[model samples]
Target: MAKLQLITPNVAYEQDYKAFYQDWQDSGRAIIPSVAKDLPADFAGYVQRLNDNAQGIGLEEGIVPNSTFWLVNEENNEVLGAVNIRHQLTPYLERVGGHIGFGLRPTARGKGYAKTMLALSLKEAKSLELEKVLITCDVDNVTSEKTILKNGGRRSTDEQTEEGIIVHRFWIDL
Candidate 1:
């Protein structure tokens, strides 16, 4: 529970980001916001990709423009977590991905960082002029469900992905 700030991905935080990435790798959980998965060796390139994604440049098929932010502990300069906010949703995203995807490092969990990180992401959503946002999580992921609920998310309906995963969808008014 350090002073947290959500920042756009940048080379200035390369080292911290590497460590954060490693932590997620070590946890053996699928990285939330698939954009954060399989990071390239070039940290600069990765940062640039995140920037490009925000600008709707060089996006892969079916991918929409999105903003990615790192939640950092300002006091210690540690990368605590990340959040990806999609500017618009595709059919698949509407059903499973939602507008916001976020996660904290294993070491940062259970310290109230997720809630704060999500609150900040909601602010970013509002800045994007979104009237509301869809946020989804695994139906079994109680922690995330709680976070979404605390953030004023209203339960919509559960969706089953093609992969057969049950996803809980919620909407928050901006």
Candidate 2:
């Protein structure tokens, strides 16, 4: 691992962003980050959408104000993963999504980056004045569970979604 830092995605990171996006697609992951919902084929539009979401502009229904950050290897400026922190929870989030959601490129997995990135996201959540942050992962996702635990997350409860998926929820006090 190189010196990693979370950064707001921008035009200067276009190539790195594309690589990350392609890796996500290649991984065949079912869930994408909230900030990736409106990604356009063009870099300019993608950048604009990221800015809009950050500012609470042109948000779709049921969306809350949030922040998105890309974890980058500062040594080589490689975009490795992304994390989204919701400013506040809605009914749906309270049940399922929680306050933070994160994913790493397939190539970046199993390198302990998830734990590192998650720990960083918790700091961002604390800065938002949240006394604690809620995080949830699918029950079958062992890596995620371990990451949450390493970040001081305590198992709160498990609930089944309408889609019949069991999710484990955890909370980390600030």
Candidate 3:
């Protein structure tokens, strides 16, 4: 185990960005939605895009303002995973999507990083003044369910979206 910390994406993390992206591609997991879309192959462009996203400078329609963080192992400065925290929820979010979205690299799975990263994200959500945050995971993602529960998440409801995916929703009090 290593001491981990969350840091906002920046130019300094280009190498980490590449490595993380490669791992996701290799694993064939559905890409991490917003963070995956518009990721540039070029380093500079990617940093600029991430910066704009964090500042809400230029976002597509229906996308909410969010803060993205990478969980880094402080000892060797390797990226373990990433998380996105929405500032507030829209109607769509209330129904399905949630306040936090997180994923650890395939190589990092089952090492308890998800729970740790999620706990850290919850603190960040609290710092943003969120009294309680909504978090949801696919019905089959047991690891995510456990992480949410470990972080004080209480299951609130389950939804079957038009797309036919069963999503389990939970709320965590700050």
Best prediction by TM-score: 1
Query: Candidate 1 lDDT, tens digit per residue, 54-158?
Result: 999999998899999999999988999999999999998888888999998888899999999999999999999999999998878999999999999999956
Order of the predicted models by lDDT, top scorer first: 1, 2, 3
* lDDT, candidates in the order shown: 0.91, 0.85, 0.83
Q: Give the Cα-based TM-score of candidate 3 against the true structure.
A: 0.92
Instruction: Estimate TM-scores for all models.
Output: 0.96, 0.92, 0.92
Per-residue CA lDDT of model 2 for 17-56, tens digit only, reads 8888878777777535657644466888777676677789
lDDT of 1 at 140: 88
Best by lDDT: 1
Worst 10 residues of 1 by lDDT: 157-166
Q: 1-174 in candidate 3: lDDT tens per residue?
A: 889999988778778767887888888777664575345868777667666876787888988888888899988778878888988999998888899998888888888898999999999998888999999988888988999999999998566463787899999999
- Show where candidate 3 strays beyond 4 Å: none
- Candidate 1 lDDT (Cα, whole model)? 0.91
Worst 10 residues of 2 by lDDT: 30-39
Q: What is the alpha-carbon lDDT for the whole of candidate 3?
A: 0.83
RMSD (CA, Å), candidate 3 to true, equals 1.6
